[model samples]
Target chain A: MNFPELMGLAFVGLFLGLMLGSAFYYRNRPAPFVRQIPAFGRVRRAIGLAVEAGSRLHLSLGRGNLISTRSAVAFVGLSILDRIARSAAASDRPPVATSGESTLAILSQDTLHDASKFMGADYDPLRGQLTGLTPFSYAAGAASLIHDEATGASLLLGSFGSEVALITEAGDRTESLTLAGTDNLTGQAVLYATAQEPLIGEETYAGGAYMGAGGMHQASLIAQDIFRWVIILALLVGAVLKLVGVL
Target chain B: MKFPFSVAVAIGIGLITLAGYFLNIPVLQTLRMALIEWATTLAAVALLVGIANLFTIHWNKLTSGKVGGLYSAILIVSLVLTLGVVGWFGPTHTYSKWIFNNVQLPVEGSLLALLAVILVVAGVRLLRLRSSMLSIIFIITAMVILLATGPLFGISVPGLTELRSWIAQVPAMAGARGLLLGIGLGIVAAGLRVLIGSDRPYRG
Candidate 1:
């Protein structure tokens, strides 16, 4: 096999083996504890506050679509949405979900619907919205929704760019508790500046584990961590070898 | 039997796509390309559905005399007008380009420009939100980067340019690469969850 193909196969094998191994390990046993993510604590508090006050919680799914390269981030966002919807299902006003992509908006609706059903609550189709397709339009539309809906807390998660500042700023202006995370570097920087609690880098992918999506979600996170260490070790080894002029 | 048909379909398509990438088989490649085309078409249809959903929701708000009914009306009207114009003149036409340039680009640009002020405001609030050494360092780095990029009366600070380049190239690039690697692994894990039927987003 070619080098690239071999590398791809190795990655796939390692990922699948770790994932399946972890999943099986966690299936019968109790879910392993995930360390507290401070930002996620803020999200939980916001959900509780919204539930208590009868206020709406807003979730911006950002500008990621299912078919795009950002699909993984979008999926992570959806997983978080699922968790939030489950938590907020008992409230009179369920959480409002807005997405920049239509496919994600549709899936958000499904998530809410399923979560509400699981909690024995009615679902509101209007709550899941496609705010805008284009980047700036999406931000502007999401910002307007945050303002108009009078959300108690705005959770910004998914794939976003610098346009995320608009949404976070609006949340700040409205005095809503804003917890934000995105895969984009610029968006992360902007969110760090603007959001009350900002999650950096791969922390965005930790939402499912932090928010108690399921054991499977938590297991996947453990696998990711193990793989991360492996990658770091490999990098260090490569650097040392290069320093020694082994090549 | 508890597994949904949607999950099965997702796994099937995903495997085909993965095999096409790794296996280098001609038939699989052709099928993968066709599947990708189908996926694109599905996305376009979903976009239309999303637009329709937007219209319906806004229309309901307008009819219900909600607080933002006026804005909703404006949005719907603008959407209709823009779509009509594009349909009549075609997207390549000057009129379409003019509408995009005049309306869309300017609005987008204005939002981007607004980010600069927002960044400053956010930087100021960072200390208040999180009183930590890291927060202080973050603020200083941001200030340095801003100053480095800003026009400073034709004056050049010694070591400023080098510092900026080092920060961007070394630390920033390193963090970015790490994040990319983590994100890549996360994606693979999430996809594996789907493939293994442990997580069925499609079931939702």
Candidate 2:
């Protein structure tokens, strides 16, 4: 193999090691260092209410791809999805998830369908609703679904763009409870969403732990906190060095 | 645990890219370019998966015969017909560009226009739902933004242009930037968490 290929192999090794190590590390930790926040409980309550009322729990995996590590927001969104799917399964009413991306959509269908099967429901894999690839088109499809009067509680988690607000705004207009999280930088929609709705921060990845999806999610949150602090420190040092004219 | 060497290579190339960007090194740039080419090749393969998934989905939708089944069939027919025509006729063919310009563009454009109506409805109703100070602030700001953005109003008052520009540029820009920074940090953290394998939603 060439030098570039060799380097690529090493990089993948490092990434996989980091992921697996974090998973196992958190698995072994005693006393659960990650704290379960109240927001997750609220989400749980909303799902419970939807099930009781015979309404649907709407999940949108906002246009996120797992290929890039930069899509942490989407990963957090995925955690929420796991929480919601598990909750929905426990409830009498099943949940419905939607995704715009093919990969995410298929995975969501699989996850939700599996949850239903676990709950002893006749599991027919959900044929996902892929509205469109464009940000606005995806938002429009989600908005239309929410307006269908059958929608109970809507949870949107993923890497969204300016379309995040459109989805949240639609939920607001409807009577459905809405929760959205996105890491799309240029998404003017999220800014609009923040102004109007109750959104969790980047820590939505911890939603599984926060909502008590067992020790796994909690450990993930702990790992995330450590990494976040490291990033902050790095940024601070870089800024300080620039200010001091050291480089 | 065995790993996909291709995926590993793609990620390695990406990391080298980060070093290249930060350090301004020639070697890093060379490595990054090579990595990008590999990624492009992988992407082409991924696109095939996407196309196949789309075809399978539309075919299922067509067979279901429920509400919107016809629409699904229409979508499939359009997609296949367009592809078939393009395959036979080549790029510069009148049919290919015509199909894109007439069918795809209009459908996309109409969806955006509809979003405008949705936005207005959402804005107006947000005011009624909550008489809270924050809701009021949101409503007022939205109205200011809407009016300021309008061509007719902007021409009538020079200050409208300035105010609209400020709403779009200053508060809006700052909020977007802060949100973006937070998101970027979140992405990095998430990537680290994944690398650490703390949260494997993918593992089922």
Candidate 3:
């Protein structure tokens, strides 16, 4: 292997090791305190409101191909959806999911099914829908559903683009609580202008950890902190090395 | 200890894929390609299933006489007709191209135009609704981008172009890169969780 590729492999190996170690160590220990994030607070409130009002909670999983760069964000969306589904499983109107990708839609149904089964509620595959394939089409279909379905709260997470404005506007038209985030920069910018709670950047990925999915989720946060500092150090060193013509 | 069949399969394939990407083994490469092909095929079938679900939804709405049933019926008709044309005449045929050009393109283009308006409206509403420091900054940045890109009355303000380029290439790029780094780390952590079976999302 070449030097750069070797370095890449080493970095990935270290990352994997750190993550696995931290997750294991933290799993047996008391859960660490997670800092308060207002978005997560709003999500908790939305869950309660949905259950009490019998209004549907909606999750808009963006159009991300499953085996691609965007899949991680979509997976995070699934984690959030899993928690939401479990919470709303016994309610009169359980949470619903909409996706632009077929694979995500199928997985969403499976997640909902698992949640409902564990909660002793009947699973309705119809709740997890593949709304549209294209960006604008997905936004249109999801937006109309937001307006028509009596959605109490809408969580827009995954990979989206500037077309997210349509979904956010629809949520606003219904006076629903809309928390949105995406891996795309344009989507984040639009969401900042539109969503009630805009999850910027890594916040979307932090959904599972903040929602208390498990110890592993929390542990991932710990690993992330360490890795972040390491990156900062590397950046500084690299800058110094470049200045000295040593890099 | 035994895992559920689906979970085992998921973990096995995941490991193979990860190994294939990192390791320099011919066998691993072949295995990875095969695994990815299988996954793609599954995804394609899932698309068809998704379409069936979509049809089922609209069909139910039409049958039950729900609100906007007519729209549902129209959607169903368009979907079926388009599928028939594409399947019968082949995707590369003139009819398929005609349908895409005449139908889907206009609709998508209209939506794109609508999105532009919606973004601007949202930005305006944000200023009115929130009126916070962030919103103010957002508007200012947006103004800079717009003004720099399209000079007002074709008048180029001195240094405005350079200032916009600096804002874009420096501060904006830095912030974006930082976010990307965090996102990358988050992806790794999430993937690890799945690989280790710490989270069994596929579990029934």
Candidate 4:
């Protein structure tokens, strides 16, 4: 194999090994406590307040299609939706999930169904709504839902673009506790301005761990941290080697 | 073993797709491509299912006398009208293209244009919401870029262009690259979790 391909294989091996090892360890034992994500605490509080107020919690899964590169981020959003749905299943008003893409909307409904089943609550597929197929329409429909449904908290997560600001701003206007995150840089920047507590960069991917999805999710976060350090070390070593000019 | 038949299928297909990327095997590559095509077709079918779900939700809201039932009615009517027109004239017909260009595009453009004003409002509220050093820096950087890109009342600041380029090229680029690297690593970690049956979101 070429040097680049060899490096890629080595990195893949390292990541898989770390993830599998951590997953196995955590599954056998107890899951470790994930570092506190401030936004998660806010989300928890919002759920509590929504339950008390007999209002709804809204989740916006952005315009990420299931068959595209954005599918990974959409899955991350779905994991968070599962977490939220479980927490909100028993409330007087179940949480509502809105997605721009059709596949994600179906998955969100499935997630809600599973969460409700696990919690012994009746599942209503209507709670998982496909607000709109297009970006602007989706944002408008979601914003309207947040306003009309009396949503106490809006968690904006998924593979959003600049249109994310519309949904986040709507949440802010409605006085809902909004925690926003997306893999899109422009969306992140907009969330920084709009969202009170925004998950930046890779933090969006840690939703499953932060929300206590399972031991596997936590283990994946730990593995990611290890891989990050390895990459940093490799970069430093490469820089030093280049500086020394041993060749 | 907690791994079920579904997990095994997922892992099997995932490995084949991964191999297609790195290995010079024509069969694996073809299989990967075929699987992707299947997924795309499934996604299209899912879109139809979603449209049906949307209709049911709105129809229920309208019938049950929900607060925003009128809006739901409007949505249902609009959707039906658009679908009827498309069905009658086909998607690429002049009427359909006209509706897309004249109605849909304009509304979408308006929303995107509204984003600029919303951004400024958000920027103004940033300090009120969270008076952090980072927020302050973010506001200042945004203002600098906005001002440098436009000549305010026909007055241009000296060196502003160079300053803007430097900021965009250096600090902004570095931050973006860092975010990209983090996202790439996170995607890999998440994918491995799913492939290994460690996190079965699909099962959920």
Tens-place lDDT digits, model 4, residues B118-175 = 9999898899878899999999999899999976898879898899999999999989
Candidate 4's docking class is medium
Task: Please state the interface RMSD for every predicted structure, separated by commas.
Answer: 1.4, 6.1, 1.4, 1.5
Task: Provide the lowest-lDDT 10-residue window in model 1 chain A.
Answer: A64-73
Using lDDT, rank the candidates from best to worst: 3, 1, 4, 2
What tens-digit string does per-residue lDDT give for candidate 1 at B4-26? 77777888988898888788799
Better of 1 and 2 by DockQ: 1
Candidate 1 lDDT, tens digit per residue, A177-244?
99888878888888888888888777888788888777777888888888889999999999999999
Q: Of the candidates numbered 1 and 4, which has the greater DockQ value?
A: 1
Give the Å error, residue B15, model 2: 8.0
Candidate closer to the true structure by lDDT (higher is better), 2 or 4: 4
Collision count of model 2 = 9
Cα lDDT tens digits, model 2, B90-185, are 867999899889987897788667656766766666566556786677677777876776666336755766887888898878666655555554
Give candidate 3 regions above 4 Å deviation: A243-247
Best by DockQ: 1
Error of 3 at B134 (Å): 2.8
